[model samples]
Target: MEDPNPCERAKKWLQSLQKIENMNKIDPREAPISLDSSNIYEGFVFRGLQIDQLQEGRALCTFKVPPRLVDGNGIWPARVIMSLVDNVCAAAIMTCDKPVKVSVDYNLSYFSTAKTHDEIEIDARVLGHKGGLSTVVVDMRNKITGQLVAQARQSMHNLGGLTVTPRSKM
Candidate 1:
């Protein structure tokens, strides 16, 4: 007999959550993110990212630095950290079913480097939101020594289902 797929199970759980009419009233942390990209791009970029825990506007995100993502010096690049931070920021500010938001402004500060095979944990929190914009802060730390690796402050604008400009095909 074949063992059941955990990914399939997770999708089913997310589906059940979507069925609830009061999904927005439920604690945002309680929502399980789906892995399907057709449903959301956050899931696609965060394919291997894990949400260890969350509360209110804060989330604990974990990711492993794969060998393929390392730069020439065998360290993860700042751009990678920025991408992860942006996603984590979105996760911190929005709940399931909330309209997707795009990063309008983002900034990063690197305190250290992460080598291939390093396990990283990010603490992301939504600082505030006004009108159509939300401000988020994230601190990336090494899970092993708990040293700070990078930090980011991002501003996002809620697009509210408005179509986005598509990137030109290469």
Candidate 2:
């Protein structure tokens, strides 16, 4: 059954994420497999992501660049970096007491290269909200050297008074 209260749903989702973060090793047999693009991307990008802190309108996370995400030059690809920024920003936005919003505008800047096995720290914070739009900024930095890797600013639009239903299985 679907939870009617968005807050409760959000809380449950966050708790599940926290639980996953605390696990030392995830059993492959217990892992869920889905054809959903969002789930697939999340599973791939967040395999080594660790949630260090979470609060209202803020999130701090750490991730190690995996080999699968590296390009031929042995550095993180732009798409991977962008995906990390977008997902982290969305996680920060989810900390707020509002329904999930869809990204309408996303601006990203890459500053440095990240190689495989490089640890990156991610910090995301909600800038503000206007009417149905919320803005957030995410910063990625080298955990060891503190060099900035990338930054992203995204604006998300909330669909007020709209009921969103899940797509049924075909």
Candidate 3:
């Protein structure tokens, strides 16, 4: 379920944004970003991220893999991994306040691996954004299994303006 009142949500965003801005180092372009998970979707909350820090074009998130995220054969679904990576990657570069964005390309490299009920951590960094294009990289690894299920680098295009909207799981 989502908190649908834009007015109330905006108030919460401003309050939290101000707090983060006051105590943390941030960039000018990131002023409007909100770290509160209330803005994030519930599907992502299935794995749930433990966000340690948020900086302009940078973020660190940790996920505790649950058995529900596993497929019937006892393997983590590639879609699940991809979704996790996508959420962090998008959020990492999101606050530039661009109204519209489209994923131009995404490249992922799988190293070790992740299993059911494992805690995975990912670090995402924005590489660059020129014109309307933005590029970012994410490093993902299973904390307990010490396996790297996948890492992805993506390019996105900021469409026209920034409009924060709830995205349902695809």
Q: Against the hidden reference, what TM-scores do the models get?
A: 0.67, 0.76, 0.65
Q: By summed lDDT, which 10 consecutive residues of candidate 1 come out lowest?
A: 14-23
Better of 1 and 2 by lDDT: 2
lDDT of 2 by residue, 30-136 (tens): 54433345655556666677778877888788889989889998999988888777767776777787666788899999999999999999989999989999899
Model 1, residue 20: distance off in Å is 27
Clashes of 1: 0
* Candidate 3 clash pair list: 98-161, 98-162, 99-161, 99-162, 100-159, 113-148
Report lDDT (Cα) of residue 105, candidate 2: 98
**Lowest lDDT 10-residue stretch of candidate 2:** 15-24
Work out candidate 3's RMSD over C-alphas.
Answer: 11.5
TM-score of 1: 0.67
Rank by lDDT, highest first: 2, 1, 3
Candidate 1, pairs of clashing residues: none
Query: What is the TM-score ranking, best to worst?
Result: 2, 1, 3
Among all candidates shown, the one with the greatest TM-score: 2
lDDT tens digits, residue span 59-126, model 1: 67788887766889999887767767876677666542233478999889899999988999998877
User: What is the Cα-based lDDT of residue 81 in candidate 1?
Assistant: 77
Evaluation by TM-score, superior candidate among 1 and 3:
1
